[model samples]
Each structure stands twice: as C-alpha cells, then as structure tokens.
Target: MRTTLDFTPLFRSSIGFDRMLNALEAASRVETIDNWPQYDIAKFGEDDYRITMAVAGFSQNELTITQEQNMLMVSGQKAGEDEGQYLHRGIAERVFRRRFELADHVKVVGASLVDGLLTIDLKRELPEEMKPRRIEIATGEKLPRAGTKQIETGKQAA
Candidate 1:
C-alpha cells in the first residue's frame, strides 16, 4: 500500500489568499503552552471580558500583570521567608508565567484581589467608525417592476 499526498489543487486555488494561507500555516504550528495555576476566561458581553486566576496564598504585591503588544502576561512570585522553620512545606510559592492572546482594541481595565482570588478585567470597545450602520436603499433601487422582465417574452406589460 502507498500513500500519496496531493495539495496542488488547494494551493493553486488559494494563490490570491496569501494572508489566509499564512494564517493557516501559523495556526498549524501553535504549540500547547503549559497550563500553570488554573485560571478562567469569561465573556461578560460583546465588549467585556474577565480573567480570574486561582492565586491562593499569593498577595497582591506578589502578582504582576502587564500587557505587552497583543499579549496579556500575568506573573506571580512570593516573598521569601528569612526566619521561618517549616517542618513540612507543602504550599508551592514557585513563580509562574501565564500568557493570553488579546484581540485588537482589547485592553486591561484593572485587577483586584478578593478572598484569595485575583480578578482581572478586560474590555474591548469598537470604534465608532467600525460599528455597523444601516443604509437606506433609494426607492428606485428597491426592486425592478414586476412586469419589466416579462417584456422580453412579448407579454403585455401589466
């Protein structure tokens, strides 16, 4: 048995869509980054989003949130204890980095910590120029007369 791979037709048909082809190529190479400290991404509305990360035992000062380019990076590092003797240390204070891809015009509003949960709010507002608008078609262009097409068949115009 032999396996033959054929992509000439697909490639030839998508010549005019270099950007889309590149996007598909890029998407194929997307690697699964590690999932650190669990988090949640929620959509509140058409232009609202919220990201909540499980940051127990992490103080607000230990967490840093920054937005660079089109990526939202959240990092955590706990303060070191100098004069503490731990017999059985189970809680992990190791630093972790989590990244999220942000859409165009999306921005981080602010972050707050409550009940050991860190909440990060993000919002995306569409520009006025990008919003959809209703256009009223002129009365003449509404529709061709019902009998107009029948004229070609020698039928009397009603």
Candidate 2:
C-alpha cells in the first residue's frame, strides 16, 4: 500500500525548516527507490558516524564519492566488458548512484574501500560560536551605584 502525507499544516506553523521538510517529503515520495548495494549507517560516538556500503563487484577506480553543500553522492560504474561467458551469473554488475543528506556541521572525514566494503567516516564539528556557552549573572548587591559620578568632559561648557 502507498500513502501520501500532507505537509501543508506543518509548513504553516513551522519557521526556517523548509529544507528539513523538503527532505522528508522527498524521501516519502520515492517509495520504489532502488536498494541495491546494501549499506549500513552506524554511530561510533556522539558526533562520529560511519556509512558502510557493500559494493561486491566494484573497484576503487570505478567508484566516485562527492560532496556538495550538505549532500554526499556515491556512484560506481563497472569498467570494461565481461570477457568470459557465464553460465550462471548472480553478482550485480551495474552502475548505481546513492545520495545522502547530511545535517549542518556534519562533514565527511574520510572514506576507505576494503574487501568489497566501502566505509565513509563522518564527523560533526560545531563552530566555537555555535557551541554551548555559560553566561555569568550578577547578584543584586553587586549592581553599580546609581549615585556614581560621571566622568568629567575635557571640554569646558559655554
């Protein structure tokens, strides 16, 4: 069964969340998206994540990883044609492209391919200005005296 969601209500009340809502809506609309080359997303730490993809018949030269803004794209295309005739072929030998939407502050640190598995590491590095900070509050008794004299001006009044 297929279902459609109405985001009109959410758009009316929410502010500055258009990107998030659009991503959610796009994900929901693509019900029959391809699931080839199985993948796994795991979190090792609070802000560290890894994406592992099973690319059995693909090589490092045939795969490409790109990052644009907040989107990460991984694509693979087999090079050259099969030389020998196969009686029973089970492995998938086709081109595929996968996209991942990353949140703000999340960046692709590194990627490695070993034994048919492609692992991409991600880290969320928040800026110093955006990190949590403590604000100091002054007590009532520590307030400046209202009767304090103002600094005298160097110029003489006419």
Alpha carbon deviation, residue 86, candidate 1 (Å): 1.7
lDDT of 2 by residue, 2-103 (tens): 688989899999999999999889978946669988999999989999999999989999999999989999999999989999999999989999999999
Q: Candidate 1 on 10-108: residue-level lDDT in tens?
A: 777876765445545655564776676889999997889999998888998999999986689999998876488899878767799888878778899
lDDT of 2: 0.94
Model 2 — TM-score against the truth?
Answer: 0.83
Task: State every prediction's TM-score relative to the real structure.
Answer: 0.66, 0.83
Root-mean-square deviation (CA) per prediction: 10.3, 5.8
lDDT of candidate 1 vs native?
Answer: 0.81
Residue-level error in angstroms, candidate 2, position 111: 0.5
Clashes of each: 0, 0
Residue 20 CA error for candidate 2 (Å)?
A: 1.4
